[model samples]
Target: MTLAAGSLCLGGIVLFVVLAAGALLAFDEPGTANDGATFDAYVWRVARFTLLQASLSTALSIIFAIPVTRALARQLSFPGRVWVLRLMALPLGLPALVAALGLIGIWGRQGVLNSGLAWLGLAQPVSIYGLSGILIAHVFFNMPLAARLMLGGLERIPGEYWLVGTNLGMRPWSIFRFIEWPAICGLLPGIAGLIFMLCATSFTLVLTLGGGPAASTIEVAIYQALRFDFDPPRAIALSMLQITVTAVLLISIRMLTPKADEGHGSGRMVRRFDGRRGLGRAGDGLVIAIAVVFLVLPLASVVSSGLRSDLTKLVTDPLVQRAFLTSLVIAVVSGLFCVVATAAMIQARQTALASRHPTKPLRGLASGISASTSLVLLVPPVVLGAGWFLLLRPFGDVALFAPLLVILINMLMAMPFVYRVLEPAIATHSARTGRLAASLGLGGWNRLRFIDWPGLRKPFMMALSFACALSLGDLGAVALFGSQDMVTLPWLLYSRMGSYRSTDAAGLALFLGLICLMLTIAGTPAADRNDKRKPDAA
Candidate 1:
């Protein structure tokens, strides 16, 4: 039964992608024949810009992250170090639109940076729009992520390496060369690839900050083709191009990066002898301080600026109220669907593994199911929305099913994350309790209720909260499907920003940020708990 349910969910994802691709292909035939040259030029321009920005963004992020990660690894016991690590996680979960707004508060024409420059007697104020703004935002979002991943790699380095280096009286540079560089190298390809994929497929950040066509990415171009130009054929062409690019990148990343073993550590900090004083300590301190300010300032701006806005009026406004309600409902439904689907998949995989002599096909099926969940990432939300937009247009008004489509797409988007969060907890629970429950004749719902819920509750809630937060902040599908009746908070915030209603947008960004922040904070404890269980599991 579990396998059947899991297969059904996996099949739904496959059908969704196939139908979207089919619709895109079918729609392109007539239009491509006539506008092939125009389409080709336009796609080339967008694709070129997309790769350029993604490459630059990826480069900048990794470059900055190396120094920061090295600093973090060297300065292990600084004041507020724990809080600094926590701050890094903020950008990962923060909404793109909110982060963009916070950045504008710091870098816009009349923003803090410009004011500071003017005070310093500079005549020209720097612009935070176009390519510059996009790169900044991508770095703001991805740099910390790269640093964290690298830090994990650094942390996994055994203490003996550092001890050996200390015994030889190696300088800081030698320590980095012999001890840290090798660990970082192993992770760099995978980390770089992930950041590049994120930047290449970035939708909300690009759409929000991309000032004009010159700076626009393929994802933003796809949005413009559909919404601004009313050109479904162009949208189809762009969608296909993005799908091709994404699939190729995924393949390249897989081929370049070997899968590493998931080894559990003793959770003990490696005491390092280098960077204890003088220039090294000072440099690490400076790097950590800059990183903290860069990340925290925008979030601080969100809160301060938001509080200065007409909060009472914004909250009481009918449209704002409705958008919030709509966002809430959609987020809740999507989260529930994601958790349920992930649970089914996990159950099926566990059942397959539990088999004493599982057939090769059975093992393949289990692996395939896991891969399929992640395959959703290959098809960006905008591509899915565009394909579905074309598929449903013939039937009638697509706006009627906008909420349904958004929920489904968001659920699929959040499934891989939910799977990661819950799979471990569920597996651990089953391993510990399976035999006892079976011996006592427990099965089905009763077994799950009696044996699973107690241990699984925290992880389950964590996954649900994370899924909901992701759905709530999503702007891609809703940007395509949103109409008069189906306004979500992200769509509303984007509209306000476009309309130059900066005050209102600030207020909305604040509210959205707070909610996502709360949900993220709520989910962290479960993740910590899960991490603690890892050593035991190993």
Candidate 2:
């Protein structure tokens, strides 16, 4: 049963791509390619912009993250520090539309900064549109992630390193050169590669702030081809291009990133002797403060601006109500599907490993199942949506299948994250209990209920909540399928923003942020509970 379920999940992804490719092959006109129209210009322009923006975004995010991570590394015990670290996770799950709105609240034409400049008679010198806007939004979302990953690497360094550095009377730069820099250097390729992949495939932020053709990425171009231009050939070509580019990047990342078997450090807290002098502490403070303001101010502005909105009107608004319901149903269904599918895949792998006959074939099948869960990462949502859209257009009304497509797409999209969270726990559990289960003659439902469920419940719940939050915040497929009848919150928020309903958008942004936050928070205590239990077990 587990193997069957896992096969179905893997088959679903393959089916979508196969159907999409079939649609393109069936529908694409040979003459269109020979005619040399938008395809040529779009290929060069969109590809160029996509690479340029993703590269710049990755570089900027990592550059800004280094100083902040260093600062936080040095000043580990400041008041409210832990909360600030928690807040850093916010941008990861925060809806793109919410972040975009929050950004606009502070950086828009008549935003706080502009108004302040006007008061100073200093003609507002900033514009949060075009390439600049895309970069800012990308940085807002990615810098914290980069910082945390780097900080984790820094913290993993042994305390003896700090002692030796101080014994040598090494300056801050010298210490970093010998110790911190080497650690960060090893991590940079992976971190930067992940950031680049994210930015390269970015859809919502680029669409919202792209402003015009000058800043459009390939993902946005694909959307425009299908939605606005209604050109299937162009859309298919762009989708293919996007997939190719993503595949190349994924391959490159696999090659570039170092394996994670470097060092298992002595698990003890390091006493910091460097970066504690007056000027060094002051510098660290400034860096930390800047990072805080950069990360926090936009969120604060969203809340402050949202407060002025009338809640009664927002709740009563027909579009908001419909979109909220649609979003809730999608999130809930997708969350459940993601968790079950992931469990099935993990179970199948465990069963294969336990197989007494034809172990090689069973293990190979299990490996394939494991790989399929991550297959979603290689295909951008826009491309997947476009592929399915092209496939369905011939059958009839695409709107009828919008909800179903969104749910399936969201499920596949969340699988990687879900797998990452659950795989470890499941592996550890199997290692600990596989023999015991076999000796007891436990298998299938009985084994799962008697062993796996109790052991894996916490991580499963946490992964589910997180997957739900991710799906809740997604705008990819909804953007492709949005219409009068089918509306999700991110789509609705985008609509309001596009229609110049700033106040309404801000109010909706607040609501969306709250819901996503609650989903995230619901899972937090589970992690804490699991952590507390770990020490006792150890």
Instruction: TM-score for candidate 1, please give it.
Output: 0.95
Kindly report which residue stretches of model 2 are placed more than 4 angstroms away from their true locations once superposed. 29-38, 261-268, 355-360, 526-538
Off by over 4 Å in 1: 28-35, 261-269, 526-538
lDDT of 1 at 214: 83
Reference-based TM-score, model 2: 0.94
lDDT by residue (1-538, candidate 1, tens digit) is: 9888887877787888889878888885454445565467778988999999999999999999999999988887766787888888889889999999999999999889999999999999888899999999999999999999999988888777777788999988898897888888889889999999999999999888889888888888888988888788778778888999999999888988867743445554467988899999999999999999999999999999999999999999999999999999999999999999889888888887777999997797689778877766788899988989889988899999899999999998898889899988998898899889989999888988888888888899889999999999999889999988999999999999999999999999999999998888786653355465422112
The lDDT of model 2 is 0.85
CA lDDT, every model vs. true structure: 0.88, 0.85
In model 2, what lDDT does residue 167 have? Answer: 89
Tell me the tens digit of each residue's lDDT in model 2 across 330-404: 999999998988887887787777756647778787888877876777777777788888778778999999999
C-alpha root-mean-square deviation, each candidate = 2.9, 2.7
All candidates: TM-score: 0.95, 0.94
